[model samples]
Target: DPVVVLDFQSLYPSMMIAYNYCYSTCLGRVDQLIEQTEFSEFGCIGLEVRKQLLYKYRNDIHISPNGVVFLKDYVRKGILPKMLDEILETRIMVKNAMKMNNKKQNPSKGLNRKLDARQLGLKMIANFTYGYTSANFSGRMPCVDVADSIVAK
Candidate 1:
């Protein structure tokens, strides 16, 4: 099968904005307002609304450490929130595998169950490596060593 590589620009920054509640200054101010309240019935309602909005916004931009933004706003807001769950599950699985592998316990089960997650993580890393390689190798941001490392693994 032909590889259909899709590149997302500024994936990490977007993800951070979505996942980390780092979006609008207004939202931050609203959060502060909510926190300072002395808890009235109406104030509680407003706080709840703000909290929901903040949660929704964060879900919209779920960020990964390697800087890949899982761009699915519609899915994040509606449909299903499987993307974030999958990403989190993968992270946990990878961490477990790495830890167990270090202790030589044969992490095959964890690795196999979380292959897709592992691949996603690897893809993000590979993307970064490719960027660096291109710059270092071609006078842009090339770093063949990075590419070689990703490819070798």
Candidate 2:
């Protein structure tokens, strides 16, 4: 028997935006010492606390279990998430244009084809953002940790 599988088209990118998982949110390596090991009692720590805590924290303090700590709130928003949001938005606009154009009486094939190409390009860019970080290239930082964290998410 054959089975049909359903998947969310923009799952990865959506998760990134939802969790604010970007390079900017990364608070770098946790310290070896624990000068202050306070639970998240009051609330999630802000950027100010992040700076203070990074100096002496044995374990990951943030709410996320993805090996990387993120800012308590999306007040500033990360660069990667912002970029991905634009790309996804553009794709949606193009897709909508293509769909609406195809349903028109005239149905301009050229416009529809152009929209389709643009949508595909945006998709490739959004999907490859994660791979770009993981690629073990000399020019890049080669952050397998960040890539692995993304997978863990």
Candidate 3:
């Protein structure tokens, strides 16, 4: 099978936007911003994580111009997709469990219940994947499929 070379064009940027409340910063109330954003309870956790990643991988190591690291050839070919799949699977499990628990806890809220962990996980994975696929190419890392193509050669 010809492996699909999925790319996250602006993963870092999108991550940054989400983490920083960029949309709200432009024009949104605090409540609206909090409600509309994901992972609000985590506060600056995402920002901190992004900073650490950039500092370690992008700045210190100087991997790319935009301060986003690309998966190495070996990692991309051998490990990345597996990691993504694992993430996806875990998300599904969490979401399902959460749904069940919520339903049992409040039967009245069943119809209006929000998604649990698994659903969040699935959304996270999907968003990450989509970001990668739709990222702009300018001043960003170029595509490299040597990893995905490893099995073909």
Candidate 4:
């Protein structure tokens, strides 16, 4: 049997933007909301959203496949999603520069290398966002729900 192999670049990161996944936007697991007392764990606006605004904006949120809820961009644009959009846009610009540099009659190899490195660095940032989000041991503010939702999508 010949199995088809396909890979989507930055799928998780793109999904995070499309689905609006972020610590500040996340509402925690649905079941946990019923079992836990502290809605404050999600942050100030998030806490208020979870406690009160949730009812008013019940139809305006996103519940991931893994049961993690996030506020939609219309309700409250996620910080991570905005950052990712900038990163991805800059990567595209860098890639275009690389192509234009390569097409030059006498392109500088050093400039090409620099542009390639810049694009690669940006891509790597998007590729390993899950690690960035779940890096508790590295002193990062761990966001399990957002990271898990990125993978689930």
Candidate 5:
């Protein structure tokens, strides 16, 4: 028999963006043990259930324990997620440009190097996000609970 390995490149970042896992999406603490049907149809298209502390200020009516709880806030999206998305998008654009430049009849090595550097920087930032979430210092709102939740997923 042969051993096999499977890996998802940039899984955390992709998961965060796909699931809308951002600080703003967390609807505060969910006090009760949520039933399956509770808020079943409340959230966005891919809504899930999870257990969390219930905070009265946010007025979280229903609950679950799937980790993330998104709000219906039209005014703003999660700051962290938005930032990640922008970085990811920018990296994609840079990569595309790099590929295009490389395919040119007389490619400019300087331009290719700059694009590669840009994507590399973006990648480094994305990879450090998990640490950033749990960092005690520097982060404006560092929460272990939130960081744990993200990793758990």
Candidate 6:
């Protein structure tokens, strides 16, 4: 039996956008960001100069289970979220076109197939982005934190 995975919701992309998880937004782990920024997170004042930034903007940050910290979208929108949103939107548009074409008096099967393929490709791109961050074999550095958070979501 073949499996049909319906991902119209785009959960992974949505979650990443909701949490603003991106390499550009990541400010590294708390311990590395400040001498005692980790302490600040625990309610202890840090002696480091940049400690105040984390301490004050605590609510505005998203710390993954792997201890990697990222600024919320309010602080600075991440590029991944924007890119994913566009991909999903384009997929939606393509799907709509396919649907409308199917209802036409004499729909062109070839055009419908092309539109369907385009939408599937867009969905694949949207979903594979998380894999891009977690794949250890990838040429670039993989963000374990982002991958973990995406899984957790």
Candidate 3 clashes between residue pairs 3 or more apart in a chain or in different chains: 7-132, 8-132, 9-132, 9-135, 77-147, 91-118, 94-118, 95-118, 95-119
TM-score to native of every candidate shown: 0.24, 0.73, 0.31, 0.86, 0.66, 0.77
What is the TM-score of candidate 4?
0.86
Candidate maximizing TM-score: 4
Whole-model lDDT values for every prediction = 0.39, 0.65, 0.36, 0.80, 0.63, 0.78
In order of lDDT, best first, we have 4, 6, 2, 5, 1, 3
lDDT of 4 by residue, 1-153 (tens): 999998976887889889989887887878776566664454222453345666777899889999988889998998888988899999999999989988999998999999999999999988777678877677357766677888886
Rank the candidate models, highest TM-score first.
Answer: 4, 6, 2, 5, 3, 1
Question: What are the RMSD figures for all models against the true structure?
Answer: 17.6, 7.1, 16.6, 2.6, 8.4, 6.7
How many clashing residue pairs are found in candidate 4?
0
Q: Which stretches of candidate 3 lie over 4 Å from their true place?
A: 1-77, 102-118, 130-140, 144-153
Per-residue lDDT for 30-89 in model 6, tens only?
A: 666755533232112222336667788889898876677888998999999989989998
lDDT of 3 by residue, 1-153 (tens): 889887853343233322221211111222333344333222112211233433443322212222222333332222334445555566667666666666685553544245453466465664554344333464132222211122112
Q: Which of candidates 5 and 6 is the stronger one according to lDDT?
A: 6
Taking the tens digit of each residue's C-alpha lDDT, what string does model 5 give over 59-143?
Answer: 5331224544544334345677788888889989999999999899999999999889999999889877867777777765565
User: For model 2, how does the per-residue alpha-carbon lDDT over 1-153 read when each residue is reduced to its tens digit?
Assistant: 999998978777777777776666655333312232443221122222344555453243343454456553334577878899999998999999998998899999889888899999999999888787677754264555456667776
Worst 10 residues of 4 by lDDT: 41-50
Candidate 6 local Cα displacement, residue 18, angstroms? 1.3
lDDT tens digits, residue span 1-153, model 1: 899998964353233223431111112233343564443222113222345654666655433333222334444331112333444455656766666665765556555656656756754653343344335434453333222322332
